[model samples]
Target: MKIAFYGSSLLSSYWNGAATYYRGILRELAGRGHDIVFYEPDAFDRQQHRDIDPPEWARVVVYDATPEALLRVMDEAADADVVVKASGVGVFDDELIEGVMQRAKPHALRIFWDVDAAATLDEMRSAPAHPIRRALPDLDMVLTYGGGQPVVDAYRGFGARECIPIYNALDPTTHHPVEPDPRFACDLAFLGNRLPDREARVEEFFLKAAALSPEKSFLIGGNGWDSKAMPANVRHRGHVYTAEHNAFNCSPLAVLNVARDSMAHIGFSPATRVFEAAGAAACLITDAWEGIELFLKPDEEVLVARDGQDVAAHLAALTPGRARSIGQAALARVRAEHSYALRGEQVDQILRDRSASITHRQQQMERA
Candidate 1:
């Protein structure tokens, strides 16, 4: 299938969380013989900041996202088998969404891939005034990155025709653990951008952990964190490129994961980092969530931390041998069930089933 995507940013993983998710999923799909054209805006110019060149498997088309520019691409959109409007594309102008739907071909599939399903739902639920609130029902499919069950329920409750979770996954060959660098070899570290909604939890989980273990070095990476009043023991490394991520994840004694508000409440939506760290056999101490057991075994593969004390307990008490064993177990689990290959296969299965049903229906109609 030829699929076109409209999302926040692609071509560069520069300080953008969704970029990593897109790279993993789209590249994997391409590896499986699917064609994808990712339509990003020239506004962000993510191409300039790219650590890795865009893959040969997919094409990156930069658009203006204006009604006029979209109309110019109407023929391409109409020719594609699928057109997807992803969440948080930073350029998801209301007008653009409407324009894409208007220009969609008769056979073109439409999808709303909500990487931030929980956050989107929360925003829409609180303020019906938001533009996206009214656009939900018009989407052909509502797919999410996180929010396993609750998010799907919420999307369906909002009258979406179909709701599915694509999830964040690892490409083991790309993410598996390598030798740690001395500079990145901290006791524990959390890597995420400094966003308003996630900062408090970072403090509650990571800062508290740093405070609890004054001797243990804590590392923080990602952009927009210069102003965060981090603890004295915490090391803030502004932003690391996508190429440096695996080294950063594998170097620490254990990587810390702090879920943003949406992920915590909606559950089952593990961040992209979780699978990356797991694939690298890096020990992980994550803030507690409702459906984590489905991904990693608590106390064995992953350690769940509710607060600073919990994080401290895991770091201070966990033996090096036990940590390695747990990380190895977690890596094995991710390889078996949470790789991007797995996600791509699942998507293929769903698309194949849907296509088959459509074909059968058409045949029946012709016979009648």
Candidate 2:
């Protein structure tokens, strides 16, 4: 398929999980001979601080953030078999959404790819400022990175003709288990960028856990987290690189996951970290989430933490043998079902089905 994607930074993929998600799935699609042109609007300073260039596997096209430039690419995107208006890209200006879809509607199958589906849905539900609430009718399909069945059903309820969840997939080559780096070795580690709204959750869940376990060393790795006061037991390592992610995961006695507020509200949404931790064969201690059992077996392959106390308890009680058991079990489950190749294939299947349906309906209309 010749597909065009308007997504978040394809250049600086360091801590932006969306970039990592795109790199994993798109690389698999390209491997299968799909022609992919990913359009990135120059709205952020990622280019000035570029990390990884788009691989030869996919073509990268950067558009100026001007309305004219966006419309021009939308017209170009119209020629594609599938054109996707992905969430993020840091530019969800109402005019851009309207312009791109209006141009692409007649010539191509347009999709709204919500990488952060939970957050997007929350925004759309808010009145007046919701960019996509009014635009949903124009899209041919909706794709989500996570939020399994509930998310798919909610998109359908919002009138999407087709809604599919393509969960954040494991890129085995980059994320598989590696020998622990001595410097990153810690009893518990959490990796996520700090944002204002999520600060309270971090303090309650992450920082409190450190305070509770003064005997164990903890590490916090992400950007925008320097200002937050941390307990003495927790070491702050700002902005972990994607290349070093496997080491970060593998080196930890147990990796902790904290969800965004929206995801927490709409259960079944696991962050890309869960898959990465599992793929790296690291034991995971995550805050309680709904529908978690559907992916990783809680108490067997995964441990649920309700509060800082829970996180501390798990850490204190963990034996190397127990942690190893949890890691191995989770890795086995993820490898069997959640690789990027598998996710890419699932998405391709959905696109094929949608195309077939369109062709069939046209044939029926012509015959009638």
Candidate 3:
């Protein structure tokens, strides 16, 4: 299948949380002999922080956020077997949603891959006549990064023909344990861009923990934290590139996963960092989120922290041996069930099933 995907940056994870997820899924799909072209806007300084060049598995097309670029994308998308416009492109998203539907119709299979399903649903609820609502019924498939049953139901409520969850998974090949980097070395490390939805959680779960554990070294890797007053124990690295993720995870004594407000409430929404840190065998401490047990067993595979006090207690008491045990267990579980190879197969099957259904409908039409 020739698939054209328009999403956030794939080359640089600069401020894009979906980069690793895209790389993992696309790489696996390409391995299964599918032709993939990724379209990303030249915004967010992603070009300046380019982490890797276009991979042999897929072509990465960086386009300016302009009307001219939209025309070019529409032309390119018309020829694809599947054209997907993922949520949260950080630019011209509303326009892209309409453009993909208008141009890719009657030919390419149209899919709206919602990386942030909860937020999109919230938008739909608040504005029923939004462009996304207008586009929903026309989509051949509505796929989500996470939000399990709730997301599927919400999309279906908007008149989607089909809705599915493509949860974030581990790419062991790219994210296995690596030697720790001294530059990022710390007792606790949190990597995430400072988005409004998650800033409060970062303050409650990450920053406060740092303040409480004054003797422990804490590291933060992401952009948009220059203005915030961080605890003296917490060191901030402006932007961590995609290539350094494994080292960044391993460098810390333990890694933290802070769920954004919407995602935590929606349940089953595991951030990409959760899988990355676990894949690197970093003892993971995550802010409490529903359905966490579905991914990693709390207090076993991952430690669940409800507040700063919980995080501080974990930092104060967790032993090196215990941390290693939890890290290894989490790594083992992810490698077995959450690998990109598994997700790629699921996507392939969904497409095939949809094709069969379409064929059946055509045959029925012929009979009539």
- Tell me the tens digit of each residue's lDDT in model 3 across 87-134: 999998998888877777464678999999999999989997888899
lDDT of 1 at 169: 89
Estimate every model's Cα lDDT from 0 to 1: 0.82, 0.83, 0.89
Model 2 lowest lDDT segment of ten? 99-108
Ranking of models by TM-score: 3, 2, 1
- Number of the top TM-score candidate: 3
lDDT tens digits by residue: candidate 1, 1-368 = 88877776767776568887888888877887778988777566566687677679888877776766656654467767777878776764665567676677755676778888888898878987666667777766788897887888888887788899998988886788888887788899889988888989998999988998999999999888878887898988987887888899888889999999878987999999999889889899999999999899999999999898999999989888988998999999999998888888888777666656656776888899
Cα lDDT over the full model 2: 0.83
The C-alpha stretches of model 1 lying farther than 4 A from their native spots are 64-75, 127-131, 359-368
At residue 196, what lDDT does model 3 achieve?
98
Rate residue 126 of model 1 by lDDT: 90
The numbered model that scores best in lDDT is 3
> TM per model?
0.94, 0.94, 0.97
Worst 10 residues of 3 by lDDT: 100-109
How much is 152 displaced in model 3, in angstroms? 1.3
